[model samples]
Target: MTFTLVVPDLRFSRQAGFNPLTEMALPGLASLLGRADRNQLGGQSAEQWLRGHFKAESAGAAALSRLVDLPAAAAGHWLRADPVHLRADRDRALLFDAGLFDISAAEAEQLLSALNSLYAADGFEFVMATPQRWYVRLPQAPDFHTTPLSVVTGQDIHPHLPGGPTALQWHRFLNEVQMLLYGHAVNDAREQAGKPPVNSVWLWGEGPEPTGLAKPCRSVRADDAQVQGLALAAGLPFRALPPAFDASGADGELVLLDTLGRSARQGDLYAWRAELERLEAAWFQPLLAAWRAGSLPRVQMILPGDEATLAASLGPAERWKIWRRPARLEECLVMGS
Candidate 1:
């Protein structure tokens, strides 16, 4: 095993209205709030507890565990005052990652079984895949704080990635996607009323291409050259991109990619649930009221396997799913409403 990946279940995340961009910002809050420093990203007081047994064998495993920590307040005072948790399962009982391994399947499964058994006492579940891939889903919920938005200044309160640049641009990009999705539905509604199509914000791709490679690190202590050869043999697009470093490039187009590869072993379901609640309070409620008054145009929508069910949880809207791929933003139609 040479390269490792700790990923969040994006389906689980999408079901909860979370994008990886938003997911990437929370850990830095621990540092900003003075609750943690670089070394303290793993545990509240003891870093060894996280490093030794938190399964720091994978590439991004160590970085994943230290994502969240206990808030400054003991009794949810900060959360109560801020009330800005994510709209997904905040409780992170399961930390899932893909491990690169060269051992036999039987050997891999045996190792996975042993790890599961070892962590089972602590309510952790470990899953392993072929070719040296592994995932550890922690079952216990750890105490942590969600990133807060400053009410007074309307400022974001999460720590920025390395260069102190918060990925709010990514957040706005996702918001635009959501808005476009909603607007597309609204455009369909207006068509029935013999209305014009909606306008949409055209988005383009910019910034660094999102590659899973964190650094040129070892791949499970295997021959790096050999691993690259194997990857090429297997036709894996595994080359590390030259350091683009810039999330906000001149291109300015928002690049959306699969981001299941950077989740932590820590659980935080409260943030998940809160995000849904906020959407309900902010976006869905207004849409529903408009629908009830018949002032809202009949919106066209697409539904996926469970988007309808999930949307029901969010709020009332006419939605349908055409196809899921490179989910593109068509246009937004502002009707009479």
Candidate 2:
């Protein structure tokens, strides 16, 4: 069988003052690295890499919404609004993703209702696919560019806001939405309950629906909406990632493992280490055993980051190379860094 494992944020920031691998022991990961053939897969954000895998130029709000069976407009552009925290300085506002703000479906509905009523006259409507994932359809595509949310979390957003002919209009609408949300009763209740109020929305992934996505693998196993959406759009079978590799299944399966990304983004090294160890035990160890037993023909582990992707392809023959000693997780991290 052929299995492709995609792990996002597997590499830690070199500037974090401490090495991430030093905090954990990853025997299975180290063993895989020791025997596999390594290559660089170029540099790009996780979203960009995943988009290319599906042969999509842009797999943003509209493309993802399409996969979830949402209605689309002929000339509409995706106006994805994510709840965020805006810290205002003397001259600018620094935006931070409100990662801890857990909104319920009821709360999301209430906020979207207010937003829809306020922007309906402007030919904008809000659609909530989930409490945290919301989309808006615009009458015309905006002549502007937006930075992906992954690139701007916990950073200043003023420089990354939309830019071009329709930038001013989009900016103005964002400000209006902020003011409206700031005064809404829902936010008032949240603040009273000591929860971070749904203060503002970050508009991004602006584009029309995607077309002609490709199916690179026979089956897909992942929890990411983008992967699942691409699979659905391509009419491919998809399943949630299993707890362990099942070599008894058919060949050619694409598995996406994303536990590393969240903690890395949050700068939680402790959590990152714990998750890595868990992955080693749950996935890497089993796969390694299968390869040794000749039950699995090939396994490819792909580590994708904002800068670059590190890929290791191993087969039974490669695993038998005892001359190559298992490298520490730190050594592999340096190659990626």
- Among these predictions, the greatest TM-score belongs to 2
Residues 68-132 of candidate 1: C-alpha lDDT, one tens digit per residue:
12112122111111111122124321111121112345644544454445446856554432323
Clashes of 2: 0
- Write candidate 2's Cα lDDT for 133-177 as tens digits: 777777776678888776787677788888888889889988898
Worst 10 residues of 1 by lDDT: 328-337
Q: TM-scores of all models?
A: 0.17, 0.91
Question: TM-score for model 1?
Answer: 0.17
What local lDDT does model 2 show for residue 309?
A: 77
| Alpha-carbon local distance difference test for all models | 0.26, 0.76
